[model samples]
Target: MTQGVMSGAGCACQPVEAVTAETFARSWSGVSALAWRVPLLAWALLVVAWSGASFWGPPEMWFLYMTHWGLLFILLEMVFGVIVAAVKTPEKNPDEESGLPWYVRVYWLLYNITIPVAFLITIFYWCILKPASKNTHVNYAPNPVLDVMLHGVNSVAMLVELALSRHPSRLLDVVQPWVFASVYMFFTLIYFFAGGLDPWGNAFIYPVVDWSKPEQTAVVITLTGLFLTLMHLATIGLASLRDRLIRRCRRDSAGVYNEGFTA
Candidate 1:
């Protein structure tokens, strides 16, 4: 009778141990999968496609000039840094991996400052210099497909960064969307102003809208911008909320398991 009781207790413990090990393995596997699916690669591919298409496609000079080079620089900086880092120091712990390295952090700091500087430069070109040059041919209407691709890449990058980063506080999530919207709004204003001043200015640049009149253009641009801004805010808010809830549930489950084990 004593031997049988001991044997039953050992069997129960073995199953519990097996289950804990399985759970740990699955968690590790998930972390590994997330590391492999880096969002920067997707952004790089999109940049490459956009740049290649600009070279081969119709002569949308302004679109090609701004987007092709801008994206190239951004993508080159991001992708090169990540690839080199991966080759040199592949992350052993995927759960603790981060998208922003030291260099990337510095780069973003500079990028944030340079945005206002770039906007000032654009203002100088459009408001002061372009008025005298007599070249009233500003074409602000970019290809809708390309715009979609670019913004889509940006959205994916944001989400992936949110997922991979260790300290995903609510503050970061709340501020990011507003920052994005503000930058976009600034660019849109510049583009619209420049396009409006041009003699060949057309409202619809890429068949996405009929920007035939000033009022019509305003309505379209304002509505679209508002909608996208709201969407971005909602996406980040929901993702962060979901992450927090899931983490809390996992902690609760683990606590219960530990208590039960102690009992």
Candidate 2:
């Protein structure tokens, strides 16, 4: 059993024969419709409240930060999830796991983008930037509660969504976050040359992202790219573990049901 667990005997790391609308709509461990709806709605509300409270600075500047980018994507993802969960999915037999649809594929891609980017923003901020800010005596925390919500709670919400959702994590989808990051990097380059300022009125939007020092910034980007790769890999691992646990629970339940039937 231990070996089977370690080897991922029943994990859904890849797509099962075929993915369907239910793949994106249902919860892995839940039978009720409320499973997906309740959490998605809660996240949507929290995102709106936190974003509104912290959105006091120059309205335009909010789009310039990668933090806001993650928040915005998460909000959109949750709203999409809530809508999708409301729709009635077509029922099929256990053996009929075929006919994956285009929109379901798009929803899965959105999930791929949403989960990792949310974690990337949270880890990048708290692990790397927060300590550096302290050394420079830069108080990025104007509102401590808002800071935690943006950087800390963002990842927690994503983690919960990860465990609850039945979506499969394709390894190839790891490039999704990298593409998203590249777009923002390109924007920052244009913003730098155009002399865009951070909310603090500095010529560079982020101290760590100053293009004036191209070599240093390039190294930071390189390291960050590697970290992003690891983050996605870690997400895949966690998803596998969730699937493995679910498989075990289902197996045990089946065993008891069979024994009772025989009795």
Candidate 3:
């Protein structure tokens, strides 16, 4: 072959991989992923930045709290979600959703489960629950920003994310809420038994989990479990409804296209 022809052929033979437009763009794999993820992630990151900055006292105390746990979980899901959306390579199995890692998937379920649980904490602590028994829980100076983040924004963000994100929800997903609540319950018991102290140096993390009253603790947990179960069921119902509506719309569009073709 001529030298010029050989050089041209070699250049042409090298494979050039085409990068997708979304490769560098941050987006969600699911349809409404961006609508929900951006706000949820931004809110969680705000809280995380403040917490990491030592705004809420020692990291030791903040990390141990349930509020912080939920916050971190939100941030984790959002961060990992963006990563999976951008970096995941499509496989032969189109059935798979988001190609989320096992850890991220687990946390995703936990995040859905923890939504109501976090709100329960917020409603009780920030509402009249704290006032009814003021001496029991920690009495930190009020910061409206932190208060809103803890009690109000957390649940609101989750609900908003739910509205924007599309995912299949099944009855089996009920286990998620139980698993989350059980973990915190177990931790509370362990903390009680181990003599762990709260931010104010109290034995129990929440004033309600008194070591002296095991029966009361059991009752409280049982009630919480019931509430969580109800909430989980409601989530399933809504998800199922959404799926049906989407399918119906697609079917109708297909029918319209066929009619047009026939005409």
Model 1 residue 256 lDDT? 7
- Per-residue lDDT of candidate 3, residues 1-263 (tens digit): 11111121132122222222232122123353555566677878988887667544566676666667777777877775555444553434432444434444654565566556666666656764457446654654257677677767877876655444444344555677687778878888888888887767777666666666889778777877787777666565654455446546554321000000110
Taking the candidates one at a time, how many backbone clashes does each contain?
Answer: 1, 0, 0
In the predicted model 2, the residue pairs found to clash are none
Greater TM-score among 1 and 2 belongs to 2
| Full-model lDDT for every candidate | 0.39, 0.69, 0.57
Residues 1-263 of candidate 1: C-alpha lDDT, one tens digit per residue = 11111121232221122221112112221453225334565656766676566543344543423334335444554554344334433334222223334443433333232222223323333443335435434433246555445434444454454344322122223234345445644554565556632224443332222334657656655665455444534443544454446556555322101111111
lDDT of 2 by residue, 119-238 (tens): 888888988888767766355678888888888888888888888776557566678989989999999999999988777677776678789999989998999888888888878887
Better candidate number, 1 or 3, judged by lDDT: 3
For model 3, the stretches where C-alpha displacement exceeds 4 angstroms are 1-32, 52-57, 93-104, 124-129, 132-137, 244-263
What TM-score number comes out for model 2?
0.81
RMSD of each: 15.0, 7.5, 13.4
Q: List the residue pairs that clash in candidate 1.
A: 203-211
After superposition, which runs of candidate 2 have C-alpha atoms over 4 Å from their true positions? 1-17, 32-37, 89-103, 135-138, 252-263
Residue 187 lDDT, candidate 2, scale 0-100: 94
lDDT of 2: 0.69
